[model samples]
Target chain A: MANKVLVLGEVREGALRNVSFEAIAAAKQIADGEVVGVLLGDSVANLAGELIAYGADRVVTVEHPHLKSYTSDGYSQAFLAVCEQEKPEGIILGHTSLGKDLSPKLASRLNSGLISDVTEIEGAGEDAVFIRPIYSGKAFEKVKIKEGIVFATIRPNNIKPLEKNASLTGDVASISVDVQNLRTIIKDVVRKASTGVDLSEAKIVVAGGRGVKSAEGFEPLKELANLLGGAVGASRGACDADYCDYSLQIGQTGKVVTPDLYIAAGISGAIQHLAGMSNSKVIVAINKDPEANIFKVADYGIVGDLFEVVPMLIEEFKALKVNS
Target chain B: MNIFVLVKRTFDTEEKIVISNGKIQEDGAEFIINPYDEYAIEEAIQVRDAKGGKVTVLTIGGEDAEKQLRTALAMGADEAVLINTEDDLDELDQYSAAYILAEYLKDKEVDLILAGNVAIDGGTGQVGPRVADLLGINYVTTITDLEIDGTNVKIVRDIEGDSEIIETSLPLLVTAQQGLNEPRYPSLPGIMKAKKKPLAELELDDLDIDEDDVEVKIEIVDIYLPPQKAAGRVLEGELSQQVKELVNLLHSEAKVV
Candidate 1:
């Protein structure tokens, strides 16, 4: 059966996040029918053109004062209203903070099946299979929805967005939704110092482990990351030792990241830590110990003190940019 | 106050996952109570100790899961319950699991329920919120600190890089985050006490839920290991030379720079 798939566009700081476009790409794969983009936030109607430029056939806008900030209750109620009216056969959303909080609740309310953090989609129609990581990244599971609506959240950077066509246009329709009696409310969103790139969505990530020694040791890694237009991460050991904040930790208990390039500096790759970043396209490990387990998974290994090696590499990169 | 902590038995995080014939090989593998759920269990015990309540650890699994329930009991839960689904079900998903749990708790006098932010194995982070939704109760996820006073609850939840403070009333559910508390190890005495503690085993019939009503919505089509990473090219020589070679490879080979 041809399925109308709804892609929920995510907005941050009044602009569409990159994952929104990535979600449109994922929705295009599952959607044999119309691909509709659903935008829910204050003044989100103007963002529909961007979704249309990617791949959405039409856009549905739900703007309300209550949805200015993302609260699970409020977003779920708004999304559920959109689902009820559209009765989409499938739903695709970014596997982000907002998606993680709202997808499960919406799926439960609709009695639908959900595959969260899906990295790939295979087949089509009723036979469509969604692939997601299990046991962290140690294993992958391909799941299918047996009945009801097919709901899935796509991890950012895994699915490439469709090329933009400025000529393409879609009908933008406004919908009235009654968002009321929310059990939870977001009085305000306290954003951390806004970095250029989201660590989870960055194309390149430079991570430090216990060998970084102290919080100050992260300076070189941060410099390399900044040069590469990326973000910085840390292992649980670094965070546990108070070398870095838990927010920067990437491991079994921390945020799972899959970037195009991952540089592990002074990290003795523990299984818990490998569970998070082993999926990166290219992994580079820098450690003085040649026998370090991180080398087992890295594409490139450098056996040297990160302090000396990192500064040298940074200088080399700088020289390359200047010469080019 | 009456507290419940939901626990699950998962493969040890350190165990190398092996998949055979499209399923995880479990024979001879070590299993432990999910590490995150340990934090939930510990938090429940502390709450019970301070607020004058009993903590009951619950799990929905087969007979093998009793070990995990016992571990939770050993960690200081006052009671334990194992909702055995071995005979009646072939598959289970988050929705079905939450449905069964909500049905069981709907009639119980529950003030607060605690669960891990996400099971390490599935990593979905869905069950706690789904159960709260099913029971029509308020819930907070990834909570680092929780304090209860009378009927009001104050919670600090992790939000990526920051934290958010929320205020709500009782009949609440919260998922324990990493920084919540240090989980206590099972002492010898605690282990012996756990062996004698009341561990009740119930079935779908006991919870008044039918097998069909709680049927799994999603189907597992295949399970397999991720593609293996190739052996790394270990760059040798002095620090400067290694750095030179690394940058050269990053530019020409990996094309990353």
Candidate 2:
């Protein structure tokens, strides 16, 4: 029998993020018998019942007042202690900023190998192979880890989350964590404050570029995004020129996203920008320029000014929703 | 602040990669400084210019890596150091390589050490932080913005869809992300100066690093090209028909819609 696969559950404000369930779904395909999920945080222990519903045979809860707020040292030390006890074959972590900080430290301490930002996983018996992009998402590399223990940090929105089972059961084990010895402290955290939608996890995204003309030009695109219940993204050009916030920029030099539906509004997609979001399920490009490279990959392209087309799209979506 | 920027010579991403057996085949690909490291070198030069100090660009690669060293010099680094070892640097694991560099830097009065967040070639963002941990200096990765005021450094990191600001003391190790600064091209005079500037060559034995200090943990069993793309379907007929066909293909075949 092989070692059980473990997933590090990620949650914010009590609700589980999509990446947590996706990690479990991925673990199920790779592990033979049991898939264990580890939940860390205060008052986050109750989420374990939800974890079993997502397909975990066991849930390890690390409950500490210090764990309530994420400190790099606390999380790493706690996770390291968990690995010491469980001795699982592999651990899965989401490739968010937190995971990026925690994974390498954990891998270093365990003397284990980590495959970062993995897009796919395949397992045959005890051998689990991971596929990830290299050269800044220009190409993909499949790495086989045949060492002591394997660790992987998966990119969010890349994997599909499994449906909730609702009939599963699992034991919740709590591990104690010490609060002292955390070196780097986060002085301040500034959130965007808008609850419109999380672009990072959204299945659908409508992106604008410099071609949108001005900040006001984004209004129709925002309406379209709202109608679709998605988030609005932007190209580097749009962000650099102050057409939108830098948070929305998507490119090799910016945020990498892979959504189910990616609609480009007046965006002459540069290759660097495309490299980030090219893995999207369906790309619909709307630009007046017929020669835009975005049309090369777009499943449906509209060659017209976004000002004319986007408003019609919002109106059409509203009518369709009302009719349905 | 006296800064040192570490760079690696890697294959350009523009070239089509060909992998054979378990290694990346370099039959016809032209290698250059990993693109992200350029940002680190640029930031180092900027710091030196502002603070009135020298910036040294260091690398542990083959003789041909000198071009990238000269490029770094041309970009405004005052000096260059190359650990001219016979070992294939790509084959040499990062721990051993960083250990060698750390041993070398112990002698220099380095106030700051900068590196690319991750080498595009290896795609491992481990070296900077791992080296920091080994040296026991504070390490900050994925730094989008950096400010040096006296000795206190302000590092702005992009967290989960947000930014976290952290303040730490100097003599720190930072891994710079893209957009930290725009890299400068070598001026004609800068290129001429690079030619005259001395780039010292050293051996693995020259450095005081102990061989046993570097513990190699990870072994890459194999590396291969990703699967080939299937031929894409072109929806033909009228605009509405094409849209309908594309929608069907997306919802049913892709299954992600």
Candidate 3:
């Protein structure tokens, strides 16, 4: 049976988030019929062309006054309406804060199954299997929907977006939605000071652990991250020690990140911490301890004081960039 | 006020997992009440203590899970319940788990229910909200702070790097996040009291849920360890030399530069 998979495009700060394109890429694998992108928010119609360029075959825009900001109730109601109208066989969304909050409600309302934070997809058609980290990335599980609409939220940065084709065009249809009786209202969204890149979506991440010593120890890591156009993260040790905020903690209890390149500075690889970043394409560990667990998972291990090593690498990177 | 906390038995976060024949090896693995769920249990105890209520911890698992339920009780819960599904069901997914939980909770006078933001083993973070949806109540996840005053609830929920303040009525559910509070260790007296606390073991038949109605909607196809990365190349020499060599490798081999 041909499956029309709906890709939910996420918009943040008047722009399409990278995960929107990544979800479209994931949808392509299971979509045998049409890859339809569903955009819900005020003034989202303009983003349809971007979704199409990233691989959506068609776009459905749900615009309403109440839909301007994200509330679980509003998005759920709008998304449920789209699902009912389109009758999609599958729905793919980014495993983001918005998606995490909305997907479960929608799934329950639709009485469907959902696999969250899926990192890989194998096979295709009705038998499409999803690979997700379970036991906190210590192990992986392959799961399949038994019946009803197939719903999944892909972890960002894991799925590469399809090649963009500017020539590709798709029909954009606007639908009116009634988003009322919301129990929760988003009066405002206070984002953390824009740190250039989203930690979860950054291509490269420079993370620190307790060995960073103090809050000031993060300065070098931050500088290196900023230079590389990446993000800075911390281990639970650092967060617990008050070296950094819990928001930057990456571990079993914190955010799970999988970047193209992961730099663990002064982080001893606890299983909890590894659960968050072990899947990074290439791991580089810089620690004074040669036997640090982080080295077990790293592709390159530098047994030296990160304070001395990080500054040196920063200079070399600067020179390398200038030469290039 | 009647407070309920949903707990799960998961592998200790520090345990090194071993997969044999496509399944996690659990013969000697240590099982603990999920660390996140401990936050829920502690929060439930605090809420009950602050505002006159009885805290009851619940779990849907085998008899072995009684150990975890006991731990919750030892942490100050007034009662515990184990909905044993060991014999009736071979597999339990989030949907089925939520269905069973909702069925059990639907008739109860639930003022507030708490659970972890996500279980480490499954990490779906779906059960609490799914149960809320089924019971037609307001719910929130990743809550860092929760305050209740005579049916009016105020909460601060974690959203990525930021936080959101939400106000809702009672008869609510919230999943506990890491920053919610530091969970307390069970005292010797609390452990002794937990031994005599009401620990009821029920089954699917007791909940009046038919086997077919609560069937799992998803199937696990395989379980395996992630492919191991090749051993790391340790750069030998002084700090400066290692940094120089590391940058060279990043540029020439890793191509990350």
Highest DockQ model number? 3
Q: In terms of docking quality, how is candidate 3 classified?
A: medium
Model 1 CA deviation exceeding 4 Å by range? A193-196
Model 2 TM-score is 0.87
What digit string (tens of lDDT, one per residue) describes model 1 on residues A1-324? 437999999998789988889988888887778999999998899899999999999999899988887777778888888888898988999988778878888888988778899998888666678999999888999998888888899888898999999799999998898877766655444555224578889999999999999989999998998888888899999989988877788988888999989999999999999999999998999998988999999999998889988888799989888877
lDDT of the structure predicted as candidate 3:
0.89
- The DockQ scores of all candidates, in the order shown, are 0.67, 0.37, 0.72
Candidate 2 chain A, run of 10 with poorest lDDT: A315-324
Superposed by TM-score, candidate 1 places the C-alpha of residue A84 at a distance from the truth, in angstroms, of: 1.3
Residues A138-201, candidate 2: write the lDDT tens digits.
Answer: 6676776645666788888887778898987888888776656656667887776233577778
Give the alpha carbon lDDT tens digit for every residue of B1-257 in model 2: 78889898987645556777756777778887877788899989888888878899899878889999999999889899998766623445655666677778876878899998778666767677666665666777877788898988988876645667887777888887766777888999999999999899987677754445554544565566544434334445554454555445545676544
For residues B98-194, what per-residue lDDT tens digits would candidate 3 score against the true structure? 9999999999989999999999999998898899999899888898889999998888888887778887778998999888999999999989998
lDDT by residue for model 1 (B173-254), tens: 9999888998999999999999999999999999888888988888898889988877989987777888888888988899
The DockQ for candidate 2, computed on C-alphas, is 0.37
With candidate 1 superimposed using the best TM-score fit, by how many Å does residue B115's alpha carbon deviate from the native?
Answer: 1.1
Report the C-alpha displacement of residue B242, candidate 3, in angstroms. Answer: 2.0
Clashing pairs in 2: none
Q: Please state the error at residue A59 of candidate 1 in Å.
A: 1.2
